[model samples]
Structure formats: structure tokens, C-alpha cells
Target: MNLSFKKPSVDTCSKCDRINMKLKYAFVDQATNLKTLKEHQEAFKAAYEEKKANKQLAQSSEVVAVITFDLQQCLPTTYLQTNVAFYKRQLWTFNLTIHDLKTNKAFCYMWPECEGNRGANDIASCLYDFIINQLPNLHPNAKKLIMFSDSCFGQNKNSIVTTMLMLVTRLSPQLQFIEHKFLVPGHTHMEADTDHALIERIYTCQEIGTN
Candidate 1:
């Protein structure tokens, strides 16, 4: 008699479940109020469901890798003063977060701008770097790519971004198709927004000094 062996299954998380330590700290303040706690719970549940859905879709080997990205308007280092003799021009911080649905991870990149420029080319450069260099290693099995961004003409919704995406398909035989989608001008709630919220929370706390 011949016996066949099958390996025992090991459970693995579809995505990293590590909560941001800073975000958790912020949540502690919200937990103090009953109404705020309820709101937080609802938002948390919605976010979890979204992540779970993305994970399930990505399990299929042939699934297209969805890249959702957005450029945040540069933030000033310090709060603006109404009447200051110094006339300090605030330093700018450029932020972008690309969330890959296949990996269920958001890769954040921040650039401090001494040159004071945040144009379409700047956004394109960061995105192209990810597609050409980082994405292959992140999701090698990907066959198609879909990108989502807000309809900001100066940054994402212009011809330059469209042209770059077309060029990306030619970079690899494995990437057969690429498409870009714009969320309606008003309604966009994705991973990138969550990242921005975290940053804002940290910034606000720093500005107000946590009691």
C-alpha cells in the first residue's frame, strides 16, 4: 500500500494587524466619552470590513494589484501667527501614501521640501519609482494594475499621470494592462485618508501639548 502525505496548514494573516502605537494613544482620549467611543467603534468596524474585503480579493493569484494613492497638500511645520515681526515662512512637508490592495499595506513616503515645489512631476516621480522599483518585489505575481486617486488636475488627473501609467505597462510583459480611476470629487475614503488622519492627529497633539 502506498501512502500520500499532505502538509498541515499554518494560519497566516492576510495583512499586518499591527495598530499604529500613536493612533492607539489618540484613541484613548476618545474612549473617555460615551458618544465618541460609539462613533470610534463604528468607524473601526467599517475599516476592518474594508481591509477584510481587500484581502479576500487579493488571494486569487490572477487578481489585479490595486494601487490607491494621493498627494497631501504640504503641511507647515509650525502654526501660523497673525501678527509676527519675524514673518517666518513655514517649511513644507510633502506626503504621499500608496496602498497596495494585494499586499493590504500602505507605503508612506514623506519628503521635506526646501525647494518649495509640489507639482505633477513630483507626484509622478514618486509613483514611477514605486512601480518600477518597489512593486515587483512587493507583488511579483501581479498581472494587471489599477490605480485610484482623487481628481486633482495639477497632480493626479492630468495627461502626465495618464501617460506615465501607459508607459508602465511597457516596462514588463507581466503587466498586461493598467487603468486609472478617479473617485468622485467629493467621496473618497481609503487607506491614504487613514494615514493622513494619523499624521494630523499627531500634529494636532504636538501643537496643543497633550494634557
Candidate 2:
């Protein structure tokens, strides 16, 4: 054996050297492509300014009232048993509307049943009738009508609910049904103070056994 050991041959490792060079170039390119702090700051400032302007505009405009409806099954309780004996549960739909003082606009509609005797479609029709007939009569000078309701099978189904909605629209052209701009999800509490109180009081008074 030779006393001196030869160093690993660089000639045989040319491919590895090339790969390392390529990786170095790639890293440098990636670093150069990254956004600078000044650029990021400018973008963030622009976005913040835009949002602030939008907030100011929204604040300036008048906020309108929103109407909503909820359906509940009036079960034949001990008190109501005498009057409502035949049915195990009586389905009652509540229509509520709230008027915004600032905008002078009104929104009204009926709530869809989550799980009960009343299907989503039935509640939707009730709401449509109230909107087309009742709303205009209630607020003659209202600039716009905003109706809100829950998403339930009867409300969102295509077969019957869509047809009913279309028919309603045709029947009453004055009451335009804006589909996409309905009530905010999970925000009925905001309008409940105005609409829900009166409706509940009336229903309570009109209970089967109540005088």
C-alpha cells in the first residue's frame, strides 16, 4: 500500500459542485424577490387608509331597520290543552319588522323552522306574503325593504321555495325581493329588541287559554 492517501477526487464530484452552485443561485434569487420592509409598510398603509375611508363613509350613511320572523310550535300544554286539543302541537309563525329611524327604511320577514311541523318552504311563503302585502302597507314611505331569515330546508330548497319566491315577486312588483342581501346570519339579536318584543306580547295575550 502507498504511504500517502490521495484526497477525494473533485473531478468525480463535478455534478455535486454544480448542484451546490445552483442552490446558492436559487437562494439569492429568492431573497432578492422577497418584498422589502418599506414596500410592505406602504402596502399596509394603503390598505389601512382604504379601510378607514370606507368606515367613514359607512358611519356617515344612515343605518336602516331590519325585519325578521321566527316560527314556533305552540304545543298543547296543560293550559292550552282545552282549546287546542285536536293537534298535538299548533304551528305558529311570527312576523316581525324593524324600522331604522336614520334611513327611514324597513325590513320584515318570517323565520324558517329548524325542525318542526312547519317546513322551510311554508315559512318562506308566509314571509313573502308579509313582505309583499304587509310591509308596503306598514311603511308607505320606506325607501327600501330589508328582510332577514334563517337558512332552513324550506327556505333554501330549490324545488318549491324558489318557485314560491318567484311567484311572489311576480304577484307584487312593487316589493322587490333582493335575494343575496337578506339578514345577517346569527345576528337576529340586534333587531330582536324592536320587533320581537311586540310580537311576543301579542302572542302571549292571544294564547289559547288566556283571557
Candidate 3:
């Protein structure tokens, strides 16, 4: 297998794009946009660096556990690569993936469309159960948690999830604190993404049907 390692630097950030566009076409105040763009990029780099440092610390010490979670793209309930399948309606399946940076272990909280929707409540419930019930048992020595995710206003970044985490920290005696951080909006490629890629590989190769 001829493989060459490549660093992924996808330019998909909306802020970056908008600023670049304004600069390119001379739309806005050039000085202001340039300063804003520089600040945004610096913040992006700083976030990545902080996550990196936290991961190393979590791996070395048991006091901290670093985790990143993401909701995978909805999967078709019954799928076949054919024209007939395209015309037919399909049930949707949702999965939220949580990956531990220290252990490289991933946990998937999944459900069918009939069972649940992937909204703020759905996400918060899953997280609540995991943090309150499972996380401590899994990482007994982890007293602090550092979590990373995208800045989706509806899901992870909203008031509901924030309040849930605040409550979780208070309710769970094992946890001293929880720190949640958002990765750069468009550049949130994470460890869970690799887990999803493996799942996708197997998913696409096989057929799924309701019995």
C-alpha cells in the first residue's frame, strides 16, 4: 500500500471564509476585517493547542479525563445501493459517539427515529446518563473532565446542555468539575470522526433491513 501522511488543513470555517471574501473583493473595512481574521485564526490555534495539552495530561495522570463527542450523520434504517431503494422511504438511525482521549475507547449512544430524536434533550439525556452513571465507573480516578465538541447552538452549546453539565457536576460526587470547549466551527475533525469512519466503512459494505 502506497500511503503518504498528509496534514489536513481544510478551509471550511465560515468566519475565515467571510473575512477572506471581504478582503478579496474589498467589501468591508480592510483594516477591521484583517484584524478580526487574525484574532479568529489565533483563537483557533489556541483551542487546538489547549486540547492537545489536555489530552497529554489526561493520559499521564488519572485526575483528568478528556473526551470529545459528536453526533454522526443520520444513517438509513434500511439501505441498498439501488434505484428502488432511492425511491423508497427509509427510517433514520442516529448515533452519538463519545471518545476518550486517555484510553482511546469510544462509546456510542444510538437510537432509531421512533425511539428518539437528536435534539438538545436527546443529547443532554444521553450525556447525563453517561456522566452520572457510566463515566465515573469507567474512569474511577478521573475527578475532572474536559470535553470538546462543535459549537452547535442548538445542541452542545445551548443553555440546556450547559445547565445539564452544571447539574451533573453538582450531582456526581466523583467529578470535581467539567470544562467544555468548542473547537473551531468548521475545523472540528476529531478522534471520534475516525471511529465514525470505521463504522461507515462497515456500514456501507453491508445491507440493513428491519425484520
Over 59-119, each residue of candidate 3 has an lDDT whose tens digit, in order, gives 8988899999999989897757788889888899999999989888999999999999889
Clashing pairs in 3: none
TM-score, candidate 2, is 0.40
User: Relative to the unseen true structure, what is the Cα RMSD of model 1?
Assistant: 14.6
lDDT of 3: 0.88
In terms of lDDT, the poorest run of 10 residues in model 1 is: 10-19
Worst 10 residues of 3 by lDDT: 202-211
Model 1 misplaced regions, further than 4 Å: 1-56, 78-87, 206-211
The C-alpha RMSD of each candidate to the native structure, in angstroms, is 14.6, 22.2, 3.4
**In model 3, where do residues sit more than 4 Å from their true spots?**
4-11, 208-211
- Regions of model 2 farther than 4 Å from truth: 1-65, 73-117, 141-144, 155-159, 180-211
**Each model's total of backbone clashes:** 0, 5, 0
Query: On a 0 to 100 scale, what is the lDDT of residue 153 in model 3?
Result: 84
Model 3 Cα shift for residue 159 (angstroms): 2.1
Question: Which structure is stronger by lDDT: 2 or 3?
Answer: 3
Put down candidate 2 lDDT per residue, 26-65, tens digits, no spaces.
6665443343433444554554454344334433543322
